[model samples]
Target: MKQKLIVEGHNDILVISHLLMAKNLRITGYNTKERYEKEFVSIGTGKSNNDGGKENALKAFKAALKTEELDRIGLVVDADSETANPAIDTWRSIRNILQQNGYQNLPAEPNPSGTIIAETDKALIGVWIMPNNDSEGYLEHFFEGLINPNDEFLEEARRITEGFVSDERNRFSPTHQQKAKIRTWLAWQDDPESPMGLALRDYPRLGYMSLDTPLVESFYDWLQLCFDTYVE
Candidate 1:
């Protein structure tokens, strides 16, 4: 059976595809915005580069419904980058789409453990807002949380990141401070230019601990359940 997972950006497709592999979830196919398969569950970005973000995730969701052999689907978007609060606004819009499609038992709030909607006669659907469903943040914030406490350079990298501001020298949006910090940590790594995907693959060396953190565990569990990947 084939499943689909949709997210918000190019790196998400890369990061998550690799993250699943780290968890021993087999991604039979390779990367892209159309599909990534954990136990053959495909991963894709929500929108085109010109319009990527939580706001456009719905477009990807609608398209995933058209997969040739779709069985189930999972969607992950940042809560609300502008405010980083609970993703009620994001979830509300998604709920409308789900309801319109006859997917029932929609919840008013995203589950802190991640949201899964499986009913007797409808398609299985799951939704997760990053940095946990309860907080306000984007993918970078989520990546930052994946860092291991044991990593020696995390604090130093954070200190370096704090040294800069949103001035000309630092052009990243204020909401993306985590991105700079994570990337700074990555830049100091052996390869010096590892993307989010490789950062996860590098693990201990990159200060990223994939499976041990509660955040990672919960997310992995959500994927397993969403795609019907079970252990014997």
Candidate 2:
């Protein structure tokens, strides 16, 4: 049985692929135009460009439902919230999308683990909001959570990052605090200037924290439960 995993951007595809590789689960089919196959769960960005937000994500999902080879599907998108509060509205909107796609019985709220997985007549569907199911943020927020609190420089890093973003000349949006945090931490890495995906992939070499953090463990477990097998 084949599965499909949909995400918002290229970085997301790279991050998830690396995560799976860390667990010895090699991806069997890379998403090249004519060679794409269903032997392994297919992973791809929902939009061809950066414009593929939640709406396009849903469009991609509905489109995937039409594929005969897909027996399971998983979605990962940034919550895009303004605070660390629960993303209730975000989850509700997603549930509505599923309902429109013929799944009428999704849970009223995200499960405690921030994962939603249920069987539809055609396939198994699962959703994970980036950062966390409850958080109002993006993948950067999730990476921020992976940083070890006990690191001696954590407080100083926070202070300097907060000051940098607060500076008028930087002109950074206050909502992008997670981005600032992760970027600041990355600056301390060996490369000192890699993107989020590369930063995560090079964590071991850069002296950054590992991806095996608690939250990441839960997420990997959810991935295993959702795409690691076939139901029928």
Candidate 3:
């Protein structure tokens, strides 16, 4: 029997999926369009609200689990703005719901010594939690790692993000401050050349055309990795 693995990650999963699909990997429960739409709407409207995307993601995860012989499943969530550890709280909530529904085999935090509670025959290999913040550079670092050094997608992504941020209407539009910071930083990149050089340039406005290639490539890679590990 083939081993199974499920990764429950933040919106970055969408990016990963797009990359993987480009490689022709068979990934389940990933929606590149939805991810793009969410980002576009959030930036355009300046609202932090994810609407029903997360909920829909959860539904997709559940459906995948039911149909696949999942050998290992990892639940990934992001810690919200309030520093009270929203990610952990969300995990606990998910755990409760699973328990209520008679599903189990979840690993506790600080793994290795953590006990696994198996409520059902199917057991999850692990549950990993990663905090999603604009600062501290996880997402940016991840993107940088994925993007080719010569790729223009990075610049374009920055521009698109900047365009939204520079618009005064979006400055206070409920979007995460970190996202705003990224956009602002991208815009600053286009300023007149100076002694400061390109060391710390800001982001600029990335048009829709600029995002096509990189977005597709990144999403495909992510999907392939997930499918290889998770699909039965």
Best by TM-score: 1
Output candidate 1 Cα RMSD: 3.8
Compared with the true structure, the alpha-carbon lDDT of candidate 2 equals 0.67
- Candidate 3's C-alpha lDDT? 0.39
Compared with the true structure, what per-residue lDDT tens digits does model 2 show for residues 1-232?
A: 5667777766676667666655555433433423323333334434455645666776677778766457777888777565444466667777777777677678887764656556646677778888778767787777777666666565677787788766754556777666677777777767787776676667744455677677888888778676643211
Per-model tally of clashing residue pairs: 7, 0, 31
- TM-score per candidate: 0.82, 0.80, 0.41
228 in model 2: Cα distance from truth in Å? 2.5
Candidate 3 residues lying further than 4 Å off, grouped into runs, are: 1-11, 17-52, 68-74, 81-83, 101-128, 132-170, 186-232
Provide the overall lDDT of each model, using Cα atoms, as 2-decimal numbers: 0.71, 0.67, 0.39
Model 3 worst lDDT run, 10 consecutive residues: 195-204
| Sort order, TM-score high to low | 1, 2, 3
lDDT of 1 by residue, 115-160 (tens): 9998765668888888788788777777878777657777987776
How much is the lDDT of residue 157 in candidate 1?
Answer: 77
Model 1 scores a C-alpha lDDT of 0.71
